[model samples]
Target: METLRNEIQQLKAARTVNVKKDVQALRATHAGMEAKVLKGEKDLNTLRNEVAQSAEKAEKALETGALVLSVLSTPGGQKRKMNEIS
Candidate 1:
């Protein structure tokens, strides 16, 4: 009877160690998933920034083209006479 009790106690201790190892493995898996999510979020933010910058650059180009067209269509363009000497 004493040997049976000792065997039972040893089995319980082994089960406790196994449970702790399983818990640690689960924690590691969770940490890895969290890291992946954070990396994806960072990449998403970078893409957003690139899109915004491209839009701003396009807007500025359009404004510049409009200004040049307005300047060329005005009377000042034809009024310029550099060939006439005083």
Candidate 2:
């Protein structure tokens, strides 16, 4: 009976150590995943800003094109355009 008790204690201690190691590994993995999530969010924000800037630039280009077309439809503006081209 004494020998059986000692064996049981040793097994319990080994299991405790293994559980602690598993917890540490899980914690490290969670931390790494959190860092990756943060970086992904930052990248998404950067992409959103780029998309907004591109949309603004496209809108400005469309406005400028419309203004040019309106101006070209006028007789005086057409004469000026011809003069500039020459």
Candidate 3:
């Protein structure tokens, strides 16, 4: 009976060590995944900012183009009126 008890104790100790190792491995994997998620979020924010800036620039350019077109067409309209009268 004493020998059986000793064997049982050793098995329990070995099992405990294995459980601790598995826990450590899981913690490491969780930390690595968290870092990757944070990096991805940072990258996404940068891309969003760049897209917003690009959109603003395009809007400004379109507004400027429209104004220039309206200015140029005004003179053309006046000429057309004169030509029509002639």
Candidate 4:
């Protein structure tokens, strides 16, 4: 019975040590994932800002193109543009 008790105690101690190691590994993994998530959020925000700026620039370009087209549609304006080009 004494031998059996000693064997049980040793097994329990080994199991406890394994559990502690597993906990540490899990915590480290969790921290790494959290950092990745933060970086991903920052990247997403940067992309969104870039897209907005690009859209604004495209809108301005379209407005300018429309104005040029309207100006060219007039007869006097066409002559003026041709003269300027020459």
Instruction: List per-prediction Cα lDDT, in the order shown.
Output: 0.90, 0.98, 0.93, 0.98
RMSD of each: 4.8, 1.4, 5.3, 1.1
Per-residue lDDT of model 1, residues 1-86, tens digit only: 99999999999999999999999999999999999999999999999999999999999999999987786687765344332422
Candidate 2 deviant stretches above 4 angstroms:
75-77
For candidate 4, write residues 1-86 as lDDT tens digits: 99999999999999999999999999999999999999999999999999999999999999999999999998799998989999
Question: Candidate 2 on 7-61: residue-level lDDT in tens?
Answer: 9999999999999999999999999999999999999999999999999999999
The better candidate by TM-score, 1 or 2, is 2
Q: By descending TM-score, how would the candidates be arranged?
A: 4, 2, 3, 1
Q: Candidate 3: where are CA atoms >4 Å away?
A: 77-86
Tell me the lDDT of model 4 at 63.
100
Error of 1 at 20 (Å): 0.8
Model 3: per-residue Cα lDDT over 1-86, one tens digit each: 99999999999999999999999999999999999999999999999999999999999999999986776589586676668779
Worst 10 residues of 2 by lDDT: 73-82
lDDT of 2: 0.98
